[model samples]
Target: MSESTTPLVWLVIRKDDNGNRYRIGSYATKAEAQQIADRLDDRGPKQLYWVERAGQGGAQ
Candidate 1:
């Protein structure tokens, strides 16, 4: 298990009924991410994906 001392928040927002669904979040693992997804109201055909960090770069 990949455990991070720092906690993160997961978010899913849709622009409208006709518009596409947008998945946004900050999470340490997929287990935590799935928890957040289960709490949402399903009203569309869109899916959710994770957003990864792109920093600390090749420099590290």
Candidate 2:
């Protein structure tokens, strides 16, 4: 997908091919995303990611 479709800042993680989740979430910003990534990484087990790309969908 192009960068347009993909937001400049998004939830990135070490997940499987498909969006298979298996951990904590609710990150609303780039900083929050990075914070969660680091926290989870230290905890180990490579829990599935829960990255909800903000700004893509919402009710006006």
Candidate 3:
């Protein structure tokens, strides 16, 4: 079987004290997402990640 070549993206995930997660935005690279997370560092606690999507236009 052949694998897909879908490009990966970096997502900025923000979780509040209530444990609710929000997908703020998607970036082309991990560094780009990290920059946004750094800026929001003072706002609250959050997590950064690089996720590989499924086939073209696959659902999250």
- Sort by TM-score, top down from the best: 3, 2, 1
Model 1: residues with Cα > 4 Å off, grouped in runs: 1-16, 42-60
Candidate 2 regions off by >4 Å? Answer: 1-19, 48-52, 55-60
lDDT of 1 at 38: 54
Where is the poorest 10-residue window by lDDT in model 3? Answer: 49-58
Ranking by lDDT: 3, 2, 1
Per-residue alpha-carbon lDDT of model 3 for 1-60, expressed as tens digits?
A: 223443446676665666565667776667777777678875534443223322223233
- Candidate 2 lDDT score relative to the true structure: 0.54
C-alpha lDDT of residue 33 in model 1: 62
What's model 1's lDDT at 42?
49
- Per-model clash counts, in order, read 0, 0, 0
- lDDT of candidates 1 onward, in order: 0.45, 0.54, 0.56
Distance from true location, Cα of 27 in model 2, Å: 2.3
Q: List the residue pairs that clash in candidate 1.
A: none
lDDT of 1 by residue, 1-60 (tens): 335666554433333455554545556655666655555534346444333332311111
